[model samples]
Each structure stands twice: as structure tokens, then as C-alpha cells.
Target: MGNFLCSSSVGRKLIMSLSGCFLVLFLIFHMSMNIAAIFSEDAYNMICAFLGANWYALVATVILAGGVIVHLVYAVLLTLQNRKARGAQRYAVTVKEEGVAWSSKNMLLIGFIVVLGLLLHLYNFWYHMQLQELLGNHTNDFGYSPADGVSLIRDLFAQPVFCVIYLVWFAAIWFHLTHGVWSMFQSVGFANATWYPRLKLISNIMATIIFLGFAVVVVVFYIKSICPACCVA
Candidate 1:
């Protein structure tokens, strides 16, 4: 079955859709977890600690990594196939694709930016946090416990540059998810004329929620760090 799937175009797309769905769910959970920090530092840190360096967490991380790799690999394969099939079309005067969103056309580019952002994010958070704990360092270079996500957030967002970068990354995520969510359903055969619009609506709503949720975390922490008087009573 696995070999057959890899050999066929449809099977590879199905695999991409499945893995993409898995990662989408994880993003929702991750955004929710970060939202907890806005209301309660203890709750956020507690959740962070709960998910750090433990066997279950490690297993989940590995699975998540596998999904990302699979999705990316299939994406490249699809792009190459399309280019090869449409080699002549590349030079023809392109007619605009009516009703298709801009994101749909540029998914590959958006996906690449998203991947780069994820790498930067991992370097900023995962390496300093969970990876530290996994390596038996109770505290990071800043002397805060590796599980001390509150401290990490405060210090990291203190720099306006990083805040801006994160906001830009989140914007890229918005574009990616808007197309990705509905497109995944379409790939799995849910894109009939009637259902396509509805799925697109749902996709926009989800993409907005995720972007706003993540942006809030970065912006709020940055504000707090920049102006203690505004945050502190």
C-alpha cells in the first residue's frame, strides 16, 4: 500500500493532505496553549513543563517532524510534475484563473516561507527550551528554568526586531493556511461547486484565528517588555 501510494500521483496527494491535516490540528493546539499565557503565566508554564522532553512529547515531536517532511516532499514532487507536464504552457500568455485566490497560485512560495519561519522559530524556542531540558540543562543561559516559558517570552520579545519578524511570519502563516486548509479538503474530494465556497469560508476563519492568536502572544509580550508601567500595576 505504501509503495503503491508513493508510485501514484493521487496517493501522494492524499498522503500530503493527511499529513497537512495532522499539522493543522497541531497548530491549533499550539496556538491555544500559547493563548493560556495571556491570562495565566502559571498555566502556560505548567503546560509547557508538561510537554517538555518527556517520552510522549518526544514521540509526538518525531511524528510531527515526519508529517512536515512528507508534506514538503510531496509538494516538491507535485510542483515538478506540473512543471514538466506544462513546460510549453510556461511560456504562453497566462490567462488569469478566475475565482481562485492569489494564495492558491502561490502556495509553493508561501509554503517555503512558512518552512523558513518554522526553522527560525525552532531555533528561538525549541532549541532554547525543550532541547535544553532534553540535554539535562535545567536552566538556559539566562538562568531561568528551561520550563520557564514566561521568562523566555518576556526576554525574547523585548527586542522589537524579533517581534516584527514573528508578526511577519504569522502573516505568512495566514496566507499559507487560508489556501492549505480548504485545498486539503479539495484534494480529498470535497471540492464540489457547492462545498468549495463553504470550505473556503471555513479556511479563512481558521487561518484568521490562528494568525490572531499567535500574533497576540508576540505583540502582548513585546508590549509588556517595552513598557513595564502599562503592564504592571
Candidate 2:
């Protein structure tokens, strides 16, 4: 079983599908947490405190990191394998293929953008908060407590440049998810004549929901930063 999984094409895709699904669930949970900050900073901070540098959170973080690594590795391997199989034919295609989503064609490019965004996010939040906590520092370099997610959000989003960058990142993630979600199901043997369109629709809806969920937090915080009186009143 292990050899098959490591050596077979179908088995490799199965791995990607499983890891992709795991990451999608994490995205949903993260979006929910970000939404909480919009409603109540106190509640959001409390939640962050519970999760910050704790044993369970750390364990989950390690596992989530593993999933991300596995997903990325498999995606790259699959792309290379496909390109090798196609040979020069890959470049010979001049006309756009019918029924194929543009996102489906450019997933690797979009995924690269998503990864860049993830690195920025890690440096901004995780490095500041959880890493500080692990290093025995109560407060981050920004002069706020490590778990003070609300303040961090406010400080970062207050800069219009970061706001634009994050929004663009979210859009890239949206593009990645649209094809990824459908591919996840397809890899698991769900593709068929009747279910193709349905799966595409489902993937689009899930991607849009996640996109809106994360985008709303950034948009709301940016607005509050510029118009403090507007949010308070």
C-alpha cells in the first residue's frame, strides 16, 4: 500500500485530494475566527489566547504544516509529470480548450501566488504572535501582547498598501480554491457525466464564500482605521 501510494499516479492524486480537503477545512475555521474579530475584539483575543502557543494548538499547527507541505509537493510533481507526458504538445496548443476553466489551466501559477501570500501572512501574524509567545515574550515588537490579534489587524490593515496586498492575495486564493475544490472531488472518483457541472458549481460557491469571509475582515478593519468615528458611531 505504501509503495503504491508513493509510486502510482492515482495514489499521488489521492494524497493531494486528502491534503487539499484538510487545508480547505482549516481555511474555513480561520475565516470563522477572523469573522469573530469583526464582532468582538475581546472575544477574538480570548480565542487567540486559548490557542496561542498551547500544546494542542501547536500540535494542530504542525499537522497543518505537514498537510501544506504534502499538498504542494504533490502538486508540483503532478504538474511536472503531466508536462513530461505532453512533451512538446504542451506548447503546440494555440486554441483555448472548451469547457476548461482558465483557473484550471493556471492553477500552478495561482498556487504560487497563494503561497507567497501565505508566507507574508505567517511573517505578519504567526511570527509576531505565536513565535513571540514561544520565545517567552509577553508582548510582540509592536508593543501589543502576543495574543492581541485585534490590535495587530488594526495596525497592519491601517496601511493601505498592506490592505491592497492582502486583498490581492485573497483573490489569488479564491482562484486556487475554485479549481482545487472540484479537483479534490474528481480525484476521489466523483466525476461523471451528471456530476461535472454540479461539482464545478459547488466548488465555485465554496470558493466565493471563503473569499468573502476573509475579504470582509480586511475591508471592515481598513474602514475602521480610516474612519474610527464611523465604526464607533
Candidate 3:
């Protein structure tokens, strides 16, 4: 069974699907954390401090990183394997297939964008706060307390360029999730003739919800930065 999972195509996909699902769950949690910032910076920072450099949080972070690595590695392997299997036929098919979403066809490209965005996010947030804390720093490079997530968010999104870049990143994630969510279930044999459409709809809804949840926080913070006095009241 272990060899089958490690060596077979179906096994590789199953591993990828499971890891993707795990990451999606983490996204929901992270999105919820961002949403909390919109309501109360104190509350958000409390959450961040609770999760920063703590044993459990470190363990969770390691697990999350593992999931990300596994998912990306398998995605690349499967894409290459599929292309090899298709050979010249891959280029020969010029017409669009019914029910094949554009995201499904261009997932690898979108995945790269998603990864680049993820790296930017980690550098901006994780490196500043948790990594600093782990390194025994009391404050980040910006001089804000490592746990001061609200200030970080305010500073990062206050810039117009960052706001635009993050919005674009969110769109890339939406594209990835539109196909990925349902595909996760499909890999586990949960998708079929009766359930495919339903799963697709669910995936779209989930993607949109996550996109809006994170985007709203960025937009709101940018607005607040523009009119601090108005926001205070």
C-alpha cells in the first residue's frame, strides 16, 4: 500500500489532493484571522501573539509547510507525466473540451502565480513576526512589535502598489481554487456524474467567499489609511 501510494499515478494524485485540502482549511483559518483585524486590531494582534513562536503554532506551521511542499511537488510531477503521456496529442487538441474550465487547462501557470504570491506573503508577514520572534527579536525590521499584526497590515496595505499587487494575488488564488476545491474531492473518488456539477458550484462559492474575506480587509485598511480621522469615529 505504501509503495502504491509512493509510486503510482493515482497515489500521487491522492496525496496531492489531500495536501491541497489541508492547505485550503488553513486558508480559511488565515482568512478569518484577517477578517478579525477589520473589526478590532487588538483582537487580531491577540490572535497573532497567541500563534507566534508558540510550540503548537510552530508545529502547525511545520505541518502546513510540509503540506505545501507535498502538494507542489506532486502537482509538477503529475503535470509532466500527463504531458508525456499525451505527447504530440497534447498540442494537437486545439478545440476546447466541454466542461473543461480555463483554470483546469492553465492550472500550472496559475499555480506558479499562487506560489509567488505565497512567498511574498510569507516574507511580508511570517518573516517579520514569527521568524523574528523565533530569532529572539523583540521588534521587527519596521520596529513594530513582532505580534503587532494590525500595524503590519495597516502599513502593508496603505501603499497603493501593495494593495494592487495583493488584489491581483487574491484573484490568482480564486482561479486556482475554482478548479482545485472540487478536484480535491474528485481525487478521493467523491466526484461522479451526479456530484461533479454540485462540487464545482461549491468550489466556486468557497473560492469567492475566501477571496472576498481577504480582499475586504485589504480594501478597508487602505481606505482607513486614506481617511484616518473618519475611520476613528
Candidate 4:
């Protein structure tokens, strides 16, 4: 079992699927919270306070970080192993492209782009919010306090450049998830002939929902920033 997990393609893909599914759940929770920020600042801040550097939340954060690290490491390892197995024939052409799409062929590149976006997101929000709270500095730029997540989000999205960058990052994430969600299931033996199309459709719907949920918050907040008079009485 140990050797299989360490050295086998199927085992690595299984790990990737499990970790990817875990992250998807996390994204759903996060997007829901972000959507709250759009309706009520106090409610959003309250949610943030609940998740504030408390023991359980911190532990969950650590576990989530570990999952991301493990998934990324295994992805790189598997890609390298596959490349080595293919040797000089890595670029050989194949007429049998019926089962493969562009994304399946470029998962690594999409994964890298997704990782880069995640790093930027972590720096913009996590470092300032949770990490600061953990270190006991609970006040941010607006003086609203560390877990004042609504304020932090509003401030960040108010900047035009940052808003544009975040939009781009979210776009990359959407593309990554569109392929990843179903592919994970396919890896775990759930994508037989009858199930493949259904799973792909479900994946697209899930990806679209997540992307729009996140995008709406960013775009709405940005618009609010630009036209505060329009939102206020």
C-alpha cells in the first residue's frame, strides 16, 4: 500500500481526487461566506469572528493547507513520472483523441495557474486576516479589527487594479475547476460510459455556480465602491 501510494499513478490520482474534493467543499463554504459580505457587513464580520483564529478553525486551516501541499506535490510527481515513462516519445502524436480533451492534456498547466492565483489570494486576505489574528494583531487598515472581514474585502475590492487581478484569478480558477471536478470522479472509477456525460455536465454546473458566486461578490463590491451613492439612500 505504501509503495503504491508513493510510486503508482493510480494511487497518486486517487490522492489528488480526494484532496481536490476536499478543496471543493472548502470553496463552497468560502464562496457562501463571501456572498454574505454582499448583503450584510455585520453578518459577514460575525461569521469571520466565529471562524477567527480559534483552535478548531486554526486546526482546520492547517489541515486544509496540508491537503493543498500534498495534492500539489503529488501532481508534480505524477507528471514527472508519466513524462519519464514516456521518455523521448513524450511528444509522439496519437490518432486516438476521442476520449481526451484539451484540458485533460493540459491539467498540469491549469493546476500551476490555479496555484499561482491561490498564492495571490492567500497573500491578499489570509495573511492579513487569519494570520494576523493568530499573531494577536486584530486590527487592519480601516481600524475595524482583524476579523472585520467585510471591511478587508471592501477595501481590497475597491481598488480597480486589485479587482481586475482578482477577476482574472477567479477566471483561471473557473477553468481549472470545470475540468477538475469531473476528472476527479473519473479517476475514482465513477466515469463509465453512462456516467461520463452526466458527470461532465454536473461538473460544468458546479464550476459555474462557484465561479459566479465568487465573481458576483467581487464585482458587486467593486461597483459599490465606484458608485457608493447608488447603493446608499
lDDT (C-alpha) at residue 48 in model 3: 94
lDDT of 3 by residue, 176-216 (tens): 99999999999889979999889999999999999999999
- Give the Cα error of residue 158 in candidate 1, in Å: 1.5
TM-score versus the correct structure, for each prediction: 0.94, 0.96, 0.96, 0.92
For model 3, name the residue pairs that clash: none
Candidate 2 is scored at a TM of 0.96
| Alpha carbon lDDT at 226, candidate 4 | 90
Model 4 agreement with the true structure over 30-105: per-residue lDDT tens digits: 9999888878888898998898899999999999999899889988988888888878755566664776767767
The whole-model lDDT of each prediction reads: 0.89, 0.92, 0.92, 0.84
Better of 3 and 4 by lDDT: 3
In model 4, where do residues sit more than 4 Å from their true spots?
89-99
Residue-level lDDT of model 1, residues 97-215, one tens digit each, is: 78878888898899999999899989888988899999999888889888999888888899999898888889998999999999899878878989988999999999999999999
Instruction: Report model 4's TM-score to 2 decimal places.
Output: 0.92
How many backbone clashes can be found in candidate 4? 1
lDDT of 2 at 70: 95
Residue 145 displacement in candidate 3 (angstroms) = 0.7
Worst 10 residues of 1 by lDDT: 87-96
